[model samples]
Target: MAKLTDMEELASKIIDKNVQSYMREALTCYMTGAYRATIVLSYIALFDDILAKLDVLAKVNKKAKKIYDEVSKKRGNQEVFESDLINQLSSNNLLTSLDSTFLDILRQLRNKAAHPSGHKPSAEEARFIYFESINRFLSKEILSTTQLADEILASTVNKNLFPSTDITTIAKVVRKELENIHPDTYPYLISKLIEKVPSSDGIVSKNTSFFITGLTFDNNDERIVSVVRRMLIEKKSQDEDYFTMIIRSITSNPIVLETVDDVTFKRLKVIIQERISEVDSTLEHSRFSHPVSMFSSMCGVLNDEVISNNFETEFSSAIEKFLYSSYLLNNLSKSEYAKEKYIEILMSKAGSSDFEVANKFARTCYTIIDELDVILTDQNAFKLIVNLLRAASWNAFGAKDLRNAKFQSMPAIRDKARALDLNDKSEAKKIYKEVFGTDTDYENLMGKYVR
Candidate 1:
């Protein structure tokens, strides 16, 4: 519907000079009653715009550049033909379904007009080619590739431009363009996007979640870990979903735990310890779901041997403090398996030859005193006494004092074990004999306590 004057205004805005010239010639042919010429020339202008855009975008996209190179080679430095551009754009998602259909219609019209097999279009059809197809579709699509890149960047950084648009759609377009044109910006863009999540949760649209996850999947390494660290530190509140998302992504990712450096690992350990401590502080008032869930997820990272090895001392200290302070013993009383695991970790540390480690483990053992009725199995009671003895062997007290202390504690252990009926009296005798070896004083201690 645009007149020659209006068409010229549209033509002047095209960034590609060649495309502008072709557009003008096509418009001129249509106005001068040259219907067939207008159709052919309009198609030329549209095809040139597509090729020029593809060429600029391809500078950053290896795949797109590869296709462009092939098209150039086969066409011998001539412009890429309309059919080739349409097919490639359709496959690449640059053109939507309706866009492809319109392009197909133009291609068929161009073929009919150019090849000259008795298909002469009327003036009205020529008007449609020049004003509707060229002006509305092709020319409107022809922003300089740099302009296209800038527009995408603006949509991403400026929230108001595409207010209703899905952030993930914008991210997808940016990724596709970068995969072809600006591959180097992936890290920068990803970091910037992550920054958006904390300052304004709205910026991280639901659609954008997949984009964030996809970045981790493709680059699951130290850089991703660093991003997670910063995000966790920035998020001081107990946002369980945020914590859950990061922990699950990082844990399931292959290189995250393996490749994290010592400094970063230590930072992560401190953060998790702080979270667990927070939960411990509130154990009596709350039922321990939220922080417990967070801590449980973090245990996945701690379970890694390399991380665990580096964090042994700190880890032991946290477990000791948490168990000693919290009512976790009562909470875990119903879980036979958890009771076993807790005892194993505690007694293992208690068995250490190092006095400090043994003593720390011993203090943790004291917290379970009241819960011992249901918690101590026959096997654990044996292990518990063995651990206590091992710890006593490392006692800072002299060996003479250590001997006397062990002599004294054995009766109390026997009485407690027997009071609980933890082991058969014969089995208790067997263990006592193995350790005491027929000493008359030991035999008296055992005889007085065994019954």
Candidate 2:
């Protein structure tokens, strides 16, 4: 048996003053050899502490008070037993499963001492009750939801305080609390979880981030989904599996995806694509929104093999549309480096046996010259026009008059082309004559610009 003074010391630590006093009485009884009286007092003190916990829970859970009221109303003239209080708290979910089981054990011991069972507990059993009730239940205060949330935050805020096992325990606790649909504090808990994303250690932050995916919120109630979006944007994930986990979580959940607004979804899409693109630099460019620049970069940066596979596998039918996309083509024509890719794409199509696509590529290149200083200085641009002009079978200018836009822009093209510091001026001059030929258009061009 524990010493009498040791039992007194345990009683002194009880957080509730009333519970402490009752437990102190129980210790005094045990030290004086009143073992049955000691057991009764210990159970009374434990019961008082449980009542105090129920009172606190009542403030947040209206149902908590109802459970106690029902039990109290039924137990008229009878002292409320530990088993009754335990059942009410357990049924109402005011206590955890483990806690319910522990309380049941304490309740059975209390029954033996309260009702004169033929077998009375020895002084050792009475001492065990006194120590456990004072230290485990009464002395240790049960934290409110807000206090528990604060503890979780403190654990994750830095390395010195963060205990990995503690964090795991907190995660399960928070998840369970949320699962219980504790509306009064759920939003605050979610906010604390998300607030860790940018600042916490990556492993802890990622594990906390998983809380959103594990939750089930309403379609209209986007609080959890919004936090997830913020985590994806703000958290710099180092682990590929972590990144993949988050991406799959968001995309796979229909409710979450639907709840995310367009702007946020677009931003998330950009972040996800950027992460995926880390494997292939070519995939980093915008595929749909800025096709011209994307394709141009792909042409210049990625080798033929990568370009071929990506275009075949990823781009699919988009390849044809991207090649012929006017918005992208216009954007391409304005870029110095992109114009070369533009010319290459057009040349490739222009050389195809498909006459219609070939002719369209030629005419589009001619029309792109209307954009002042757009692509005219590029040798690839010059070569494309030369190849098109020399291929009479394509009949690129069949319906267009010499007085059309292409002819009208000849003087400007000539000036830009002539001023270019080409590595081979002779090749440049030959390219210049093939398209801006020495025909009547050139004599008229020389007359107009010779001054």
Candidate 3:
């Protein structure tokens, strides 16, 4: 039932160009009513492709290497070489029993077509051979082994091969190598990469994270989600450290949270909650700062439902407490970055459809602005105040009234607003008018408040 055009299109998917050339010739023969030549040429292409895959497998697998070596010695004898290759592949578990049987049938058809037999093949028989050969052998990559997976993972560490800081570029490099790997190898490859997450520190850590994130988010592979869920479940009880590290990494790529099942998501929520609870603002240097910042970053991306149910109170309180404490504010660069993340989290939360959620965030921002005003002696704190105000004013959620009230009540904030350059003041007035539907006369309110 297969048409010559369909057969040629399938042949084009063959990764091996040499095999493609042979299949092209076979299709040409099939079109010309040369049925015997079509069968012989298609079989030759399939066999050659299998041999090419064997060579690649041999480089990474010892069993494949042994089989390849034996096949190489018998290459002078065509019949013996073909028979030995199939037997060795079957014996080594490289080819399934069904696959071996299929190859054997194709080989027999090739034999019949090559010899001067009284029997002549029909068009259907030749088309069947062409389609079977291309689909079963020529189009698929070799079965991927653990060693091959490791080889691919190892190659990712080479800077020359993966030299991009951009995650999209790095993911492309990873995908190019992984696309050739058989699908059966994905679970093992994923497990190995997960194991690497806790220990890998530099570029290796980044590549591993981006690759896993790409699989889950970019490719939308359900198998990846299932594997990660199963692995996390196993690691949760068996290896807490491994489980925690993976959770931390997943928080960095929070879109992954959207893919997990509810139970797994709830577990992740509890773990993140436990981690955030350990943050001690009193300490001169809390080791938990990183996790807190990560959680804040995650909150900035998650939807209102997840934020309200899992993180609303805890995250808001944590950011407020951290901002109020001197520990973060004392470190200029770190404090600026943390403030930026905190403001982003608040901005996202302030957009919530739930009035209580959005209103609560406005109150948090109001209090944070008060704290920033107390610390306004620090030039960095002053800049953060302006940034937070500018960011908050842009969100048209239920918080606008609360923000306007706070702005009117705070004299120091009024003085700071009065000191703003023309562009920033104009930008602020524009956004405020856009958000609150009113233009505030900053010049009129200047003398009424004491700095």
Q: Give the winner by TM-score: 1 or 2.
A: 2
Quantify all predictions' global Cα lDDT against the true fold. 0.53, 0.52, 0.61
Tens digits of lDDT, candidate 2, 342-399: 5555555655446566656545544545552454455654454344444433454521
Candidate that scores best on lDDT: 3
Flag regions of model 3 displaced more than 4 Å: 1-5, 77-79, 96-98, 116-124, 141-143, 146-180, 191-242, 248-255, 279-416, 419-445, 448-451
Model 1 residue runs over 4 Å out of place are 3-5, 77-81, 132-451
Which residue pairs in candidate 3 have backbone atoms (N, alpha carbon, C) closer than 3 angstroms, thus clashing? none
TM-score for candidate 3: 0.58
Give, for candidate 1, the lowest lDDT window spanning 10 residues: 285-294
Q: Rank the candidates by TM-score, best first.
A: 3, 2, 1
Q: Give me the candidate number with maximum TM-score.
A: 3
Clashing pairs in 1: 60-180, 60-181, 61-180, 61-181
- In model 2, which runs have C-alpha deviations exceeding 4 angstroms? 1-5, 75-81, 143-451
Residues 1-451 of candidate 3 have per-residue lDDT tens digits of 7776788689888878877887888888988999999998887777778878888878767888998888877775543678777887887767767778888888887778889877699999999998878777787777534556777677546556656645467567767777557776688888888766555556666556556654543444656666765665434534545544554445434555665556665665566566556655454332322445445445445564665566555656566445433334333233334445455554445455555655565566555565556545333322333433434445644345534454565556555655552336665455445433565643442233211
